[model samples]
Target: MIGFFVITLGPMLYSLYLSFTDFSMLAAPEWVGFDNYIKLFTNDPKYLDAVRVTLVYVLVSVPLQLAFALAVAMVLNRGLRGLSLYRSVYYLPSLIGASVAVAVLWRQMFGSNGLINQILDWFGIEGMSWIGNPETALGTLVILNVWTFGSPMVIFLAALRQVPQYLYEAAAVDGISRWGSFRHITLPMLSPIVLFNLILQMIGAFQAFTPAFVVSGGTGGPVNSTLFYTLYLYQRGFTGFQMGYASAMAWILFVVIALVTAVNFWFSKYWVHYDD
Candidate 1:
């Protein structure tokens, strides 16, 4: 209890108070009430841009990541030879995908005249700088997020294992087609796991900062195409020294995530299943 208060609750309360003030780290915080929030919504175009970019990143990446994870998990559940080795090899990306080193490598690979362009050259196809163009910069980040699907893949694999074999056998006996069996048996059984992975991946995608920061060189550049909400908050707080405004952004993000999570739970009854 003491640790929670000290580590979580205390800082949160302090930040909430700071959100209404004007703190620049070098000077004492001045009480400003709702000014920070009002500016954020009504006056700050860049903040609105960040919100749009972040929403695009989250909406596009999370569903693709979860779908890819489920597909890989289903493939691995087929009892392939050296399953453990394959699982470990596939899982490695999730462990390092968010690292600075990986982000640097990704930037290089997506840059003009880099490996991706070279590959395109081999096929006599033109390739532009994926990480440079405003149109495609966010897409590269989405692919990166999708590449880090190992964690949810492992979870889906476990859930697939727990599904009753007899249900599949019954479907087979009833002459169900492969797709039908998957739809009626596999999907229903995996719905709960799907919901679980969706919530987690959605939240993580919203909080993502490293890839955009490193890929865009901390500017969220190319006309702010990759300006994630967190990245903008960091710029305000740490770079621009607008800590109070940053605090307001942080609280807004917290509320948005909470609302999104609540909506997911509220809608889960329509599809998510349980043993009960």
Candidate 2:
């Protein structure tokens, strides 16, 4: 509790106070009321662009990542040989995907003459500089996020094991098609896990930074297309020395994440099933 207060709650409360000031990190903080927050919304085009890119990143990556994870989990749950080894192999990416080395490797792979283009060349198809183009830069980051689906895949595998086999057997006995059984039995039973993974992935996606930071060379370019909110916050706080403004951004992000998570819980009542 002392550690939490010193590290987490203390810094949070300090930053909350700092958000209402004008601190350049070189001088004392001067109170500014709501000017920083208001300026971000009303005067800052780049801030709006960051918000737009982040929302797109969250919406697009979370669902796709969860779906891909669930599919892989279902496949691996089908009594595969060397199950433990396979699980570890699949789970490795999630462990390293956010690391600086992995992000650097990703940038190289998506470069103009990188492995991806080499593969396209083998197919007689031309490939552009994926990370260099604003249009496709963010999509590459989304793909990177999806590639780290191993964590959720592991969660889903555990949940799938807990689902009683008798349910599937009974569905088969009732002459239900495989798809129908999956839709009726598997889905309803897995709804709670789905919600859990959805919320987890959504929060993670919202906080994604390393990939964009490395791939875009900390600029969130080629045109601010990949300017994630966190990256912008880092720029403001560290790179540009606008700590107070960055604090405002951080608080806004905190509120946004809380609201989103609350909405997910509120909506879960309609679709997330529980045995109780």
Candidate 3:
């Protein structure tokens, strides 16, 4: 327990402490009070832009990702032919989805001369630079988020199976349509699972870095459309050597996520059903 505290809590506490000071990698940290936070809120347009971009990314990606996952999970739960093979195929993306290799592949696929534009050309549409244009670059990241839905799909599958078959039978006896049964019976029962997925995906989206870093060529580019908060924090800390400011940014992110999670849990009380 002591070792665990030293390894995990120690670094976190140190970073919290560092958040209040001015530190570059070269020199000892000097106490700066709330100056870093004040500067960030007032003077840093880049930080504000990063925050806005990150919120947009999280709001768009998390729900879409969960929706896609739930849809696929429903299909897979129907006992399809070659179930094991299909499951393996679906799960493969989640395993390597965050890798730099996957990001590069995504970039190639979305580039002007890539497969997507070639497909567009087949339909008599002009090829456009999807990742190069600011309008479309963020959409590409959203697609990437949706593409990695396999993990949540698997979780939803497990939750779906735990739902009682008797409940469906009861709904059938009540003359409920399939959609009606799903809405009232399935959805309420699965609300807890949905909430779980929502929180997890929201946090993942908030902290997303690799896709933006690799796909944007490490500039968060095409006018910072892909400039995620974590990526910006990395640039400030490692690239610019503003460790103190980066630490402050990180703590702000932590607080934001905590508040969001708390709000979610508060709302869940009204909707998330527990049979017990």
Candidate 4:
């Protein structure tokens, strides 16, 4: 416990200290009080852009990913043949989804001469630069995020199984159609699980790094369209050696995530129902 405290709390304290200073890797840090935070809020356009991009990415990707996962989970819960095999096949992507190899493959697939454009060409559509255009680059990342919904799908499958069989039978006896049974019975029971997945996916989306980093060739290019908050922080701290500013950005992100999680928890009380 002492070691855990030291390991976790020590770095957090160090980062707090760093956030108040002007530190580069080469020079000793000079205490600048609230200058970093002030600059971040007042003068930094890039920081604002990062915030917008992060929020959009999280809001758009997480819900879409969860929705797709729930849909797939419902399909998988139907007692299909080769259930285990199908689950394994769907889950394989999530296992390797964030790896460098997969990111590279994504880059190639979204490139101008990539498979996507090739298919579009077969339909007589002109090939557009998917990753080279600022408007569509972030959208591509959102699609990549949706494609890795397998992990949440598996979780939803487990939750779906735990739903009481008697509820369905009761609904059927009352002349409820299959859709009505699902809407009235399955949905209410699944609400808590959906909330759980939403929080996890939202947090994960905020921290998304590898796909954007690799897809943009480490440039956050196409006019910074894919410059996620974490990627921007990485460029500042590691690439530019602006440790103090980066630490400030990191703390801001921590606060934002905390606030969002707290809000979710507060909202859950009204909607998330547990059987017991």
Candidate 5:
């Protein structure tokens, strides 16, 4: 309890105080009374752009990632041979996918002379540099995010296994189609896990930083296409020495995530189900 208060609570409270003050790390923080947040919401175009980019990323990546995870989970639940081997193979990416070194490798793979474009060359088609173009830079990051679906995939696999086989047998006897069984039986049963993965991935997407930071070479570059919210906060606090403003941004992100999570929990009563 003492350690938690000193390590977590203390720094958090200090950071909150700093958010309302002017602190550049070199000098003592001078109280400014909401100036940082005012600048962030009223005067910062880059901050606004970061918010937009982060929102798009969370909304797009979370759903697509969950969909991919669920689809793959359904397949793995079908009792394929070498199930353990395949699960480990698929989970490998999620284990190291978020690392800075992996982000650098991803950048290289999408570069002009990289593997993807080289494959395109085989079909008599030219490919543009993925990370260089503003239009596609964020898209590349989204694909990277989706590629790390192994975590939720594992959760989905566990949830899939918990589903009683007798329910599926009943469906098979009823003349239910494969899609119908999934829609009526599998999905309703899996909705709780789906909501779990959705909430986890949504929070992760909003806090995502490394892929964009490393891929954009710490500049959020190519016209700021991949300027994620956390990356922007890092640029402000550590790089730009605007710690107070960055703290305000962090708190704002916290509030947004908290509200979204609350809304999800509130709405889950309508969809998410668990057996009594």
Candidate 6:
């Protein structure tokens, strides 16, 4: 606990204070109360763009990821042969999804001369560079984010396993179809896990950096379509040399994530069912 406070809490509080200053990692931090935060809302359109991009990413990616993960989990739960091998294969993407190599590979894969375009060419379809097009650049990042469904799938599998078989047995006796049983019994029982995965993925989506960074070449290029919140924060802090401004952005993101998570927890009372 003491170590956590010192290592984690200490930097957090210090950074919070820094958010109100005008530090450029040069000579000294000048005290400028709320200037950075005020500028973010009033003067900076790019910051607002980042906010919009981040919200779209979180809203779009998390649901698709959860849905895909749940579907995969349900299929795998049906006692497939060679389960361990298949499980590892599915889980591999999530493990390396954020790696620099994978991001670079995705960038290449979505380029005009890459695998996707090559496949399209085989079908006599003209291919455009996905990562180079403003419309499709962000979409590629979303696809990359969705591809790592293994983490939530594993959690869903575990939650599904914990569900009492007696409920399903009883439901079957009462002529409940598979869909009906899943909708009523399985869904209600797995609600807690769903809530858990939602919160985690939402936070992660807001903090997504690698795909945009690598795919967009760290500039959120093609008209800033992929300017994720974290990437912008990083650019401001490290690239633009505005540590204090970046700190302000970080705190704002922290607040946004906290409020979103709080809202989820609050709404969970309506949807999330606990067996207790």
User: How good is model 4 by TM-score?
Assistant: 0.97
What is candidate 6's lDDT per residue for 1-276, written digit by digit as tens? 999999999999999989998889985888999999899999999998998888998999899999999999999999999987888899999999988999999988999889999999999999999999989998888899899999999999989999989999999999999999999998999999999999999988889898899899899988989999999999999988899999999999999999999999999999999888
Q: Rate residue 104 of model 6 by lDDT.
A: 94
Off by over 4 Å in 4: none
TM for every model, in the order presented, reads 0.99, 0.99, 0.98, 0.97, 0.98, 0.98
* lDDT tens digits, residue span 58-107, model 5: 99988999999999999999999999998998898899989988899999
Under the 3 Å rule for N, CA and C atoms, how many clashes does model 4 have?
0
Clashing pairs in 2: none
* Overall local distance difference test of candidate 6: 0.93
Cα lDDT of model 4 by residue, 1-276, tens digit: 998779998989999999999999799999999999999999999888888888899999999999899999999999999999999999988898888898889888989989999999999999888999999999999999999999999999999999999999988889999989878888889999999999998889999999999999987878888999999999999998999999999999999899999999999999888888
What are the Cα lDDT values of the candidates? 0.96, 0.95, 0.93, 0.92, 0.92, 0.93
Candidate 2 residue-pair clash tally: 0
Question: Rank order by lDDT, top first?
Answer: 1, 2, 6, 3, 5, 4
Instruction: In model 3, state the lDDT of residue 112.
Output: 90
For every candidate, C-alpha RMSD to the true structure in Å: 0.6, 0.7, 1.0, 1.0, 0.8, 1.0
The stretch of ten residues in a row with the least summed lDDT in candidate 3 is 83-92
Model 4: how far residue 249 lies from native, Å: 0.3
Candidate 2 regions off by >4 Å?
none
Q: Largest lDDT belongs to which candidate?
A: 1
What does candidate 3's lDDT look like per residue over 91-182, in tens digits? 88889898999999999999999999999998999988999999999999899989999899999999999989999999999999999989
